[model samples]
Target: MKILSAFLMLLLPALVFGAEQTLVLDVSGHCGSCKKRIEKTVKAVDGTSSADWNKRTKKLTVSFDDEKTNKDAIVNAVLKVGHDADGKTADNEAYSNLPDCCQYRDE
Candidate 1:
């Protein structure tokens, strides 16, 4: 039992550390202000290590600790801030409320 417990302990860190992931989500945005808003929203989420958006690619790449927050939570954060995430859409009111220069699509 002691040997099994030791073995499990050794593997626990590996399992936990391996949960950190960097993912790119298709996020819609138009310009620099959009970039700032998108990145800020992602970084506000707990466990996010870094967040960046590319205006050309319209992709938001985020690195986060999965133990603290998952992809869906991150995506939802972006959506709440008026950007369309990979599998989620921004609320109509929120999207419409964004600055005109930040709108990426015509609604």
Candidate 2:
């Protein structure tokens, strides 16, 4: 009975998590600062449960309540802050607003 209870407890989280849909964003930016900006902005978006940005790969992993938000909203959030994600081009006006060093573009 004890072992069965423990197993159920462990499985419970997996079951719940599996049911919650998550969106992984392919973000493009320059460096650590860019990663931070993208992560912070996306996580602040309403309905986002969690967000992580990988500096090395320039990817942003976001977990949100699918019922409340969709992938387009997540991508737009990042773009609003002058970064690009999910194959959508960054807002040129917003991108031009970022500091020069934060710009991830070729001359």
- Show pairs that collide, candidate 2: none
Stretches of candidate 1 exceeding 4 Å from the true structure: 1-12, 16-18
Question: Compared with the true structure, what per-residue lDDT tens digits does model 1 show for residues 33-103?
Answer: 99999999899999999999999998889999888999999989999888999967899989998999888
Q: What is the lDDT of residue 61 in candidate 1?
A: 92
- The alpha-carbon lDDT assigned to residue 44 of candidate 2 equals 84
Flag regions of model 2 displaced more than 4 Å.
1-19
Which 10-residue window of candidate 2 scores lowest in summed lDDT? Answer: 14-23
lDDT of each: 0.90, 0.82
lDDT of 2: 0.82
Q: Estimate each model's TM-score.
A: 0.83, 0.77
Model 1 C-alpha lDDT versus the unseen true structure? 0.90
In candidate 2 the C-alpha lDDT for residue 47 amounts to 83
Kindly report which residue pairs in candidate 1 clash with one another.
none
